[model samples]
Target: QKDGTKERYVYACTPDGTVGRCNKISIRCSEVDEEAWKYVKELMKDQNKVEERLAEIEKKLTSNPVDVTPIDNQIAEIERQQRNCAKAMVTAKDDEYMSQLFQQEAHELAKARREAEKLRADVLRGMDDFQLVRSKLDEFRKRWLDHKTKLEEEPTYTDKRLACSILGLKATLYSAGHLPRYKFTITPPEIEFLILLHRAERQPRPWCVSVPAG
Candidate 1:
């Protein structure tokens, strides 16, 4: 509802006939009032801008492979420094001053290893960000497709039934451990399986297989 308007909007109605108020709702542009249409147009423009930015991010991700050569070289160099420090320690077995020098070199090698590990962690985080963005884009695209279909099509009884079935299956998957239940240390094969499962869940009529009656 607008601040100065007398119009009241009902957003959700429960099975018990209870109505609820909502802050905002998505409506077709043609259905919006003139004052509201202005804001809707602005929102559409903003959505387009966001889509453009996502596309640019995706392009960069696809075109520029993450170069891990620097991290690899850093780790390799640190390893070499540690090996040299070990040799120095072996050579300075008797002299106290030489032993102190070797110990200092060993400390420096440890510091280098720490720095290299931090760099490797930073690179991994960058890769994770890219993957997270891509996953969000895929989810958004799926939701947009569903919304468009609902708005554009005059769904028949069969269509509605199919949609209900899909929703039910999605709910079941959520209840079960099939859908994204929790973040854990999973193998690459498990990750691939989850991706395939999610894709299957998103399909309109995914339950083609027969389930035996218990």
Candidate 2:
């Protein structure tokens, strides 16, 4: 509204208030706006130019150019050294010093071979001794197992003998009227009674006669 020029107005509200002020805007383009637009266009063009240059640089970097001339030269030098070494070997084939060196190496190899053979023999002897010991141990184990089996069976044999002796003593004592009439088939309790009777008879004044006249 200033200077009698009609200007467009816009309302803007801020976070600080519910009511906002009407701001005047220019509807006609000004020379400063044109200059600002020109500046923005120029800045966009420069940015685009920078991006194009960066793309060109990236393409060059991705091409991976390499120079192998130094490596080729090193390979050529190595081949030359190998050829020279071959020529030297051919020239030195019949040298007397080389012959002596070869003979000394052969003698050392033979000495080392003899030592290896001696060590192999020692290892073989040790293996043989170990095998022999293993066999003897096996035999001892068999004997010990047999003795253990006999020991395991010994109680049964001893029990049979003890039962026979008890039966025989019971028969004799019953026949002589020193004990009660016995059943033909003796049980464990009868055997125990016979054992007690025998133990008591071994005392003074033979208790067999005083056993209730049974």
Against the true structure, what is each candidate's TM-score? 0.47, 0.26
lDDT accuracy of residue 38 in candidate 1: 33
Instruction: List model 2 lDDT by residue over 1-214, tens digit each.
Output: 3233233231122223223332211112242223323332343344454344334433433353344455455555545654555565566679978756655655655565466556656556544544443343343334323243332232322222222332222111132243332222222223233334333332211111111123
Best TM-score goes to which candidate? Answer: 1
RMSD in order of candidates: 18.1, 57.2
Alpha carbon lDDT of each predicted model: 0.46, 0.35
lDDT, candidate 1, at 56: 59
- Displacement of residue 130 (Cα, Å) in model 2 is 0.8
In model 2, pairs of residues that clash are none
